[model samples]
Target: MKLYPIEAGNFKLDGGAMFGVVPKTIWNKTNPADSNNLIDIAARCLLIEDGNRLILIDTGMGDKQSEKFFGYYSLWGDHSIEKSLARHGFSKDDITDVFMTHLHFDHCGGSIQWNKDKTGYEPAFKNAKFWTNENHWEWATKPNAREKASFLQENLLPMQESGQLHFIQNPDSDFQQSSELGFGIYYVNGHTEKMMIPYINYNGKTIAYAADLIPTAGHIPVNYVMGYDTRPLLTMPEKNKFLTDALQKDFYIVLEHDAHNQIITVEQTERGIRLKETFTCDDIF
Candidate 1:
């Protein structure tokens, strides 16, 4: 199996929102803010080439939104899914599965695109089966008032309309082997309802797709939970358990939202679990 880090694009978000109640004096040291106080955000996705299946995890926010709509997020950068795929000699059509960690726009917006006629939306990955869990599918589709803005209809529905949407059965435990994808799925609810984090066994090492649960190395501190999380209180214990397990198992964390740092490992520190080392995806495989 081969894994590729796909750079979808970059955007800026309010540092305060990203760091939640964490003081700027603390978070700014790691994730510095711009003059406007927006921090750099990456829509980093992961591509898995395992035998006949090429599975993509998280499609970054697509380019279908209006300029006014995009201005809100301050989207930046030239890196795109097409360009990133081409770098690995692959294309959208080559993707057989799109495993979404959650349905937030920055994570799964690239799942759909405007059709050629500009009449309606269509699945961006024509040949890929869009994979999401049943609980998240329902949560996103029937979003609560707080998260409604992040779950856009244009980014979803089209996958089902195109008949490429599939749901992973709820695992009986925290981690379950995904026989079809050759990885173990870890479910965490603090970030969002039933967000799936993939625990990949590759080359005698375990790589955990941190998703929003542990977005960046800076988020290694259990208290650094995102304000966007549906249940902030629940995030702490969830993160603690995951980090403890990750340290014990020596898992390489594949960061999805960290613009600069791609992967990292954590160690038990006096303060708490802290970052041990940082490296790129290629450093491992």
Candidate 2:
């Protein structure tokens, strides 16, 4: 199997929101904020090419959103999904599967696009099957007031309407050991209703497409949960488990939202799990 880091784009998010209740003095040390208190963020999606299946982990914040909508996030950088894929000698049409970590606007927004004439939306990858769990599909489609803004209909619905949306019919448990997609899935609900984190064993090393579970390196602390999470209290225990597993198993934790750090590994320090090392996609793929 071959893997590639897909740089969808970069944007800035409020450091306060990203670190939840963590003091700016602490989080700011690791994720230094800009003059506007915004920290760097990356929509660093992952691409896995195994046999005939070319799976895209997430699409990042697509370019379809209105200017004002993007302005709210302080979008920056020239990196885009199309340009990133082309760099890997591929394109949207080459993707056979779009396995979204979740349906949040930033993660799945690139899965769709506006139709010609801007009258409606359509699946961005015409030939790819959009993947999401049944539980998350419902939660995102009928979102709660707390997360309604993140679950944009324009970023979803189009895939289902295009007859390409499919729910993984795995066992209703925390982990799906084996799935048709040729990977293991851990279903956690702390961040949202049901966020599926994919783990792929490539050459004996496990790579966790962490999504928002571990948004950035600075968020490695169990208590450094995102303020945006609907259940911040529950996120602590869930995050602790992921961090412990990464430490024990030596998993490469992919920081989907970390701007500078694409991948990382943690070590069990006296203070608890801490960033052990950082790696770029070139080092792995």
Candidate 3:
């Protein structure tokens, strides 16, 4: 099995919104904000080449939204999905599975793209079977007002329309049940709802994809929950449990939103679980 980091693109978001109640005085040190108080974030996706299956973990925000709509996020950086894939000697058609952690635009937008004449949306990975949880699908499709903007129809509906959408909830499914997942599914409802964090068994090491649960390394602080969370209170317990387990198991947490650091390890300190070390994913190899 081979895993590669795919750099889809980057975008800017309000630092305050990303860090919730965490004071700017704290988070700003690590994720320095621009004059507009926006923090640059990476839409880093993971590609897994396991035998005959080429699975892509997430798709960055695609270039289908109107300029006016994209004006809000301020997408930046030169890294693109196509360029990143080419570097790995692959293309969208080579992806057999597109495993979405959730249906948020930044995470799944690249899964679908606008047709040539702007007639309609189409699957970005023509040969990939789009994978998502049943619970998250319903939550994104009939999103509440708070999360409606993040779950755009243009980025989601096309997966099902193309007859390539599949849910991963069957008990017989071993994606999460096998030791290959490293730590297995640690589903938490605090972030959005049933956000699936993949705990990968890479060689002798254990790494976890810390989706929005811990957006950045600065967010390692227990209280730095995102305001975008549906239930911030619930996030605390979930994070505490996750951190405890991660620290106990000596796991490398792969941050999906952090621009500078790609992976982080935790340690048990007087202040509870704190970052032990930081490094790029390639350093592990």
Using lDDT, give the best candidate's number. 1
Query: Model 3 segments beyond 4 Å from truth?
Result: 170-183
Cα TM-score of candidate 2: 0.98
| Each model's backbone clash number | 0, 0, 0
Residue-level lDDT of model 2, residues 25-89, one tens digit each, is 99999999999999999999999999998999999989898999999999888999999999999
lDDT of 1 by residue, 157-182 (tens): 89888889998977898778886677
Better of 2 and 3 by lDDT: 2
Candidate 2 runs further than 4 Å off: none
Could you estimate the TM-score for every candidate? Answer: 0.98, 0.98, 0.95
Global lDDT scores for all candidate models: 0.91, 0.91, 0.85
Error of 1 at 187 (Å): 0.6
Question: Which stretches of candidate 1 lie above 4 Å from their native place?
Answer: none
**Residue-wise C-alpha lDDT for candidate 3, range 83-190, written one tens digit per residue:** 999998999999998888888989999999988898998999999889887888999999999999899998888899899999876433323553322236667889
* Candidate 2 residue pairs in clash (backbone atoms < 3 Å): none
